[model samples]
Target: MRSQARQYAQSAQHRRAPPVRYSVAAAAVPIVAMVAAVYPVPMAVVVLAVVAVARYGRAAE
Candidate 1:
């Protein structure tokens, strides 16, 4: 009975694990794009491409 209680506590700990939250970098994408846009279309395109790649890579992982 004591062993079973210990096993139940371990499983409960796993179940209570926190959800993954987005980092500041992940949250800054739109801000980066807006600032990058003031430079030029080519630069904006590059910035957007980089952001997209980063976001997709993160989601894939």
Candidate 2:
């Protein structure tokens, strides 16, 4: 029973982590832009946007 509970917890964590990670990634966009303000970071923003969009698209499927 303990093993089964642990398995369930692990499965739940696996299911939950992707969306959280994606959300955190998405939320960092503005921070990226702000950092871009002080340094050469537009490319970083662009790269992050591309990654975010791609991940969102994939998740939508």
**Candidate with best lDDT:** 2
Q: Write the per-residue lDDT of candidate 1 for residues 1-61, one digit (tens) a residue.
A: 7699568656865887322333335446666678776765577576777777677657755
- What TM-score, computed on C-alpha atoms, does each candidate reach? 0.34, 0.41
**Mind giving the per-residue lDDT tens digits that candidate 2 earns over 1-61?**
7699568757977877445545555557677767777787568667877687767856854
Evaluated with TM-score, which candidate comes out highest?
2
lDDT of 1: 0.61
Pairs with steric clashes in candidate 2? none
Off by over 4 Å in 2: 1-18, 42-45, 48-61
Give all candidate RMSDs, comma-separated. 13.3, 9.4
Q: Candidate 2's error at 55, in angstroms? A: 3.5
Weakest ten-residue segment in model 1 by summed lDDT: 17-26
